[model samples]
Target: MNIHQLDINHLKSLETPFYHYDMELLANTLDAAKKAADKRGFHLHYALKANFNDRILELIQSKGYGADCVSGNEVQKSIDMGFPASQITFAGVGKSDKEIILALEQQIFAFNVESIQELLIIDELAGKLGVKANISLRINPNVDAHTHHYITTGLDENKFGVPNSELEKAASVLRSCEHVNLLGLHFHVGSQITDMNVFKSLCVKVNEWKNWFEERGTTIKVLNVGGGLGVDYQQPDENPMPDFEAYFDVFDKFLERNPNQEVHFELGRALVAQSGTLVSQVLYTKSGIKKNFLILDAGMTELMRPALYQAYHKIEKLGSSNQEELLNYDVVGPICESSDCFGKEVTLPISERGDLIAIRTAGAYGEVMASRYNLRDEIRYVYG
Candidate 1:
């Protein structure tokens, strides 16, 4: 069933200011992505940073997808959650010596190295542990992802991967490091990228980098073009599966590959965003001379995207009979900060005290980023 239909029955039972996740919808979305990736013989790794809920991780792991972790805790969590260490890939900019030691001890598949210094650190750590650490260089392809400036990471100005000019030096450093095994190359442009041209551009950049390495007598075995596929926030119902077919097709057509090379992707939001919603209740509806305000019990502490990025999510009233009565409202939450508002001048059905409200498309970065600010307690979560 759709969100509105599920809301009719579940809204009454749920406590206010909670997260609601539709497991069926999430399963379908995962299936679609898996099917598309399997068609091209591509490996998919679920980026745990998107939503690290144990239940979500269990479902994703059950689907045969690997885990992409960025921290020591995440690597441990992935292993604890039944994901094989052999299917896990650790990635980050500043990996601590402790983290490197842990991964080497765990024997994870590979480490997505971001800099030459980090590679040296890993090599040293692996040497101390008497292990050969598998590594993949995270190269900054210098391509514009054209997403939100805050989330964009591939640009030369960003503090993410090794610069394009440093590849030779990085490779030379890897060659001398006896404890580290250089596996391949990894490129992640940015996040929430809707434009397919960005992926196509990334493919071109990957091909260029591959040829550069090949010409230097280096054989790249794995090509990991990182994931930033965006979902439809305006109309979740109209486009639930996130156009995985088109996303994978772009890489299939543009990315150049060798016979021994394997392609991999790390996706997070496109898999879990649409499956969850932030459910809250309207605490009060105040009418002023200027405009109406619908105050909610949930605030930025529960879902901060609105205040952080001025992002939009479809706000709907649950179990409302007056759907046609149009009224403008500045939806806000009970937080000390004025910036804790969800939407301004939003049109919704005539609202009242205790009316249930659901913020759509909050599954990815919503609850995972929640804070205990304003002395607020954690919200409950319901899975269906």
Candidate 2:
């Protein structure tokens, strides 16, 4: 029910149901992240799966951040947008042969292999190309992220990384492969993680895993503690960016590393979520059987988080003065599905037809997940 104040006069002139990005806010977020990571000597690999907009990718690359890709095209996109192959890392659970071959052809920095078979496949493919492929073992630390179940990835139940029981097999394959170099270990617990203790638990597991590999006579070069730090979605304006300093401090305090080891983080949501908002116009305010429904042209097709995750995004009634009395209403989109509702019993100022509505904290999973369901027209993007 809390919404950030906006430039209503300027917003009214733009078309409705479009994603509005605050470039200034984005620049500030990037600067804060860079300063925090630099001070602690931690390398950042901006996760391209979060938002793959060409402008966003180029902007992040310009800031000297590395690329974290999950697919073959993403690998090429990062390189095409100016990210060097040495600074790019590819990760996924089910990578195809084509994707693996493409990554080998590009000579990417490292591949986060999830299984021993994946390691063998990469070894075979690299041997065919007569090139040594760099790889990092994606070990599942089995640490609970303490976040949503749908976003959790590091648990033993998840279909993500290799388990502890398979370490010997992984080591055997690594020793057998002649064209693969086991550079280090990688672990990603989950997304939208707010608790720092989850990372502390992960540090303990990573230390143990690193020691396991080192004891086997393998050098652990890179400790890739993947990123899942959550942002303040309920109060986006109050906390425009997540506390990156505190996040890095956790690793600095708990994670034990060798003198020659390097640290890396793959962040996505915390860097871009607050700088973008979904803008839509109210179409009608009608009384339903028991509650009032405020319908808008934008639906799940444009912003699917509310429908998919039952997520809450702060809603603001633009052009309405603060002095106006507030009322509770169910904000619904034009989609025919019953789950197309954004929020129920949302308190907003008295809204009328053509009133602009700002859906805050939609920068991460909002526009990227837009769909063509119901054959809806594609949305547009606006920059502030």
Candidate of highest TM-score: 1
Q: So what's the TM-score on candidate 1?
A: 0.97
Model 1: per-residue lDDT, tens digit, 228-332?
999889888787769899999999999999996899999999999999999899999999999899999999999999999888898988777764698989999
The deviation in Å at residue 140 for candidate 2 is 0.6
| Residue 264 lDDT (model 2) | 92
My TM-score estimates for the predictions, one after another, are 0.97, 0.97
lDDT of each: 0.91, 0.90
Worst 10 residues of 2 by lDDT: 1-10
Note the residue pairs that clash in candidate 1.
none
* Model 2 misplaced regions, further than 4 Å: 1-7
lDDT of 2 at 72: 96
lDDT of 2 by residue, 1-384 (tens): 122444677777777799888777888899999999999889999998888777777788989999999999999999999999999999999999999999999999999999999999999999999999999999999999988888999988999999888888889878899999989999999999889999999999999999988887899999999999999989887898999889999999999989979999999998888888888999999987889889998999999988987888888876677799988999999999999999999999988899998888888988888989999878788766
Instruction: TM-score for candidate 2, please give it.
Output: 0.97
Error of 1 at 152 (Å): 0.5
